[model samples]
Target: METILNVEGMTCGHCKAAVESAAKEVSGVTDAAVNLELGNVIVTHDDALNIGEVKQSIEDQGYDVK
Candidate 1:
């Protein structure tokens, strides 16, 4: 499964790395890609992935997921 999350406060490579790392750390997540210019995250995961958890994980990294 793939999900696109609109995220805010990403301004550089570090922000992209942090969001990707955080999303990948979530259980069931296969991969994560961030587009800093678009302020969005594209996540690939199994169907079992809890999207809410993914959002929270990103939030925990000091980002805002919408």
Candidate 2:
């Protein structure tokens, strides 16, 4: 499964990487990608991906989800 989160507060490569890494930390996450300009992150995971956990993981990195 996959989800696209509208992230806010990402302005550079480091910020983008932080959110991506955080999302990947979720147990079921297989991959996490961020688009700085669009302020979004694409999360790819197994069928049982925990969307709430993934969002919280990204938020813990200091980014907001839309």
Residues 21-40 of candidate 1: C-alpha lDDT, one tens digit per residue: 99999999999999988889
Error of 2 at 34 (Å): 0.4
As for candidate 1, its clashing pairs are none
RMSD of each: 0.5, 0.7
lDDT per model vs. reference: 0.95, 0.90
TM-score of each predicted structure versus truth: 0.97, 0.94
lDDT of 2 by residue, 1-66 (tens): 778999989999999889989998889999998988888998998987769998898888888887
Which pairs clash in model 2? Answer: none
lDDT of 1 at 7: 98
After superposition, candidate 1 runs with Cα above 4 Å error: none
